[model samples]
Target: MLRTGEQYRDSIRDGRRVWINGERVQDITKHPMFKPMIDVRARIYDMAHDDATRDVMSYEENGERFSVGLKLPYTKDDWHAKRRATDTVLEDIGGVVTRVGDETAGEMWSLYDGQDILNEVDPRFSTNIRNHIHHVIKTDPFHVSANTDPKGDRSKRPQDQDPDMLLHVVKETDAGIIVRGAKYETAAAYANQAFTKPTIANWGNEAMSDYAVGFVCDFSSPNLRFIARTGFAGRAPARDYPLSNKFDEVETLVVYDNVLIPWENVLFYQHTKAATFIRATLHRYSAFAFVQRNLKLADMLIGAALWNVRQTGLEHQPAVQEKLATLACYREGINAHLTAAIADAEESPGGLLMPNQSLLMTGRVLACSQLHHMMHIARELCGGQICITPDVASFEDPEAGPWLDKFYTLNENWASEDRRKLLAYARDLLNSDYAGHRLTFQLFAQSPPFAHLAAVYRNFDWNEALRFTHKSAGLSDQVWGDKR
Candidate 1:
């Protein structure tokens, strides 16, 4: 059964211990800072009922097709449906706001939540996965997010940092284990419905092995505390601000003070060998998902920019047309890589369908870099009108209205007020103190561009690359002169 938008609202209406600026939020569903974000999430729920999205957003449960994400076909056709659904959701979100703790994030985690036990206990990890699938089919779990604690300095190993800085299994019991410490940048944790598997440990020290543990838990689990960050878009006044009026993008510092995890939610507990495998496998899937999400965002931005261009009568301008083309190219490039990844997807040993690691990583790398470059192009194309646009307040003044109308006339065809609205929306996106600088920040922060590039280069099979290069140059695969 799919959860309806109203059902989603009901789920978060009460029993949530969410705090924004030291005040307990009784109803995130109605809170000004959270309502728009929640509304966008509800729209995702509405997707399941959408005529165009039903095929991908909802799956009929046949006895044979046990899992949702994996029960689907491993084909480009399937990828298209998923992309459509993702695009539908992202398009509804005009701000940085997200229900990261919502259904999508939970569904991703449940994909691997009971993974290790599947081979021996449940045999498919399908029970909970299906429940989650149905849940998302309705409301999308309301909120979900992941955390990967690098711990201290990047140059140091996890063991080198204060052990508590990373979440780890401190004690194991017959029923469960206790975990302590914290993970930085657990985005959307404050509002997400579920917590994802923590980071896998990669260190030389034996004491740090507990840090490799993985588990799923509710957001309000005992001993959990949220340290909130300042507003990005959701903090602005309702009437005038462009993006903030419609969205709230929030992040938090999640502190775990001896949290307990039931054995049922524990996916991999200090099985370091398997932990490494799960980590790498999840990394591949995350990259694939990011490619799809970021591409949709880029494509959406392109449409918005081009729409403003046409509305402002700048479409005929040579320079404006050139900038739009570049934006379009970035969109197409991301699509190409995403398609290539889907085309090359493989089935993991655990029976989960996953994409090509190298392709997805390369796409993520390109996404961050391209997104930054694209936003720069948008800023340049829009000119100072984006930054210096008059406050929406001036429109209320009778005397100023005529002056604004005369001086800001793009053309006599469209009314000045209408044009002002579009400009305000554009400025909301391109010029706001939060929206402008933060778009680049999210893109860069998704994965460090430089580290991603290094990983791609390191993972590249140079011999295979050279072989392809030679083949492309019309030489045989053996052009390297090593027949062996």
Candidate 2:
């Protein structure tokens, strides 16, 4: 059943221990650092019921309504609906938000795809993943992901180093497994639950280890401490840092101190094979939503750059147009990949339709790799005034206001207020501290550059290229023989 915004807000206020900026947060939903994002997330939940967006964001099935974003994708139409739903959220919120339920829900779907591997380990474990997937659809919880751990001591195994460095199953009981460690998760403080799993670890000779565990953790579970990073919101005026103040999804280093995972919530446990399988394909389905955020970000870059150029009549210049075109190319490159990925959707082993992995993974690389250059081009186009422009306070001052207005105003068509607002937006988007953090987030959020290329390698059809080259060079048929 669909949930209302208030229901979501009330769900996270379950007395979960949380700290941000070195102070204990009493109510995360009401905390200043978290309130803005929580409101956005709650708004997304409420959007399903809103008359204007109800049809677009939700669907009626069997006398019940379910979120379009959380629905299991089985066909091309499902993907398009999911995309439209995400686009609608970004438009409604006026900015990009990555960790909202839709982006992280697919991580569970990726786990669902690995049901066969889970069954190979233990059939019961496979059932756990399937149940969780359906539970998401039926309950429409605010799901999130927890993959990265504060892993320590690269040289030593989890045993040799502090075992708690990586989240591991410390002990077992009739109730469930007791886990202790930490995870770096975004939006965990306000979200309902997370698909908690291990980070990328090289599973050595051991078939079973404590670190090889994955579970769905409830935020209300005790012994879990959410230590969040300092947020970008409320640090300055929202008008000055528009996106940062409104859309910063506060990340938390969630510390699990013997947190109990009920038997039903455990998806996989004490099995390196299950952990390794999940590690390989964790983002198989989620990467589409993650990369889709880049598309919106690109639009923001283009809008900022184009507006700056148009304001000054610099858009007519040949060099300026070329720079704008470079931004456009980057935007369209992402758009083309997303468009074609859905057009050529492939079937997963688990009977779900997965995006064209090659295209999605490659598009992630292209969009992330070239983002800095695109930002720089946008920065160059916006010019130095973005940095040197006085704040709103200076423009509003009685004595200084006239002098500012006289120079800042281009004409009656463009007033000082409009120009200042645009420049402020451009500054925040291109040159602010928040801008740099966003760039870094995109780079490492899905993993480093090498891992992205690895996904591309794993999914790419290497044989096709090899086949074409082999025929072009007139290679002998025995080149690919079973034996040398």
Candidate 3:
């Protein structure tokens, strides 16, 4: 049930069409732009087999070992094991990389919780979702998510303009359903499959439509193309941009031109109720992993800022200490939410244990909404040296090397080379092109800011607050009316 790194690499070499920088990538496993991320994913798979990590990364069921990330949750211990596995991977990799697998797999679990709604339309649709969840555990393939479509116009209906703007069921055949459209997905180029679905939340009074479709898209199928954004690995030396070179997860615009989805792969079809249920509870479990990434990012900010002050001997300043405390508060705020969510875990409608929804949703808002300001605080603490420092080439130059060394060296313990490396790291983490892209990616990746608030509104106990206020005000029983 578990795959090796080489086996995982070989599985994606199925001759799928992928384009980046105006060139067709023949081997994604060997290409410079994609190879770094592929290697990271491969390393994660290898960790499951390693003697030291096998216990933490995998679980035994019926004499077979399976990935802990893909296992269906049943108890609180299961969630703790999953969290440890993800944290171990992040520590092993030495940086944050979302969309690897565990973070996106839970999206399918959300749909699995809606089986009753799915059964309302057809029992087969519910059966398909259950089969796919087990299939993922049995096969251990790399999976991702597909939701956002390149909806061309907001004012015009899909029928009035280009119908293909939003992904719809173009034709249903005896063999399968052929779909034509595109979706902006991260890691889809290298991932094996995606849980494809719609982003529309409101269905009004309509009960069925072509856009209300969801399926498991096999990336190796024909008529599929992956157009990726240019990567940051080969563009510069790894010494100058450490994080960018090793951790940039390239995003792709995956185009589906008359692609076929067999009946077995279809999770739901022509049912707006299923689509509505999915969008409402999409991130219920996945948000735990997504917000966990922000926690790691917060650590990066704190590490860079604290080290900068230590090098300059400013750690003794009260003002500097206050800023460091602020960063700690942000980090612990996320920690509290994640910890309490698990402690107060609730059972899903499908009988699976999920993190407390209210805490998880509110945690997502706290982590994402305050990220920009946290980055700014860290940037200020690092000073202007991060942006004004010269490149590695300038430091190694014969004429400029001596002058740069004389100016950059602070003490015998802090040499010019180490100083240069630190500034370069700080710059890449907060000021470079990669930094900006990562910030925007986190801002809108899971959904938009407004959606985060809406999730919190729906999950929070508003009735509890109303009941307390009514009792404190000594309101009459008649005033309660049917509100209770």
Best by TM-score: 3
lDDT of 3 by residue, 384-441 (tens): 9999998999999999999999999999999999999889999999999999999999
Full-model lDDT for every candidate = 0.61, 0.91, 0.93
Highest lDDT model number: 3
**Residue-by-residue lDDT tens digits, candidate 1, 1-484:** 5666777777655464556777776776776666766677676666667777666665666422121232333456655555665655666555443334322342354345335544443342345544554444444454454565636676765568777767777898887889887754433433434545556435444433777665566565778766555555455555456665665456666677888877666655555654554544445554555566667667657766876777767889998989989998888888888888788876654455556657767877777777768877877766667677676667667888678888776676767777677677667666676565456555544445665776577545577877677778898655556553
lDDT string, candidate 2, 100-154, tens digits: 9898889888888888778877787889888988899999899999988998987
TM-score of each: 0.81, 0.98, 0.99
User: What stretches of model 1 exceed 4 Å from their correct place?
Assistant: 50-56, 63-73, 91-140, 150-162, 184-192, 205-208, 307-314, 458-461, 468-484
- Candidate 1 scores a C-alpha RMSD against the true structure in Å of 4.6
| Higher-ranked by TM-score: 1 or 3 | 3
TM-score of 3: 0.99
Model 1 residue 219 CA deviation (Å) reads 1.8
**Cα deviation in Å at residue 442, candidate 1?**
3.3
Model 2 residue 263 CA deviation in Å: 1.3
RMSD of 2: 1.2
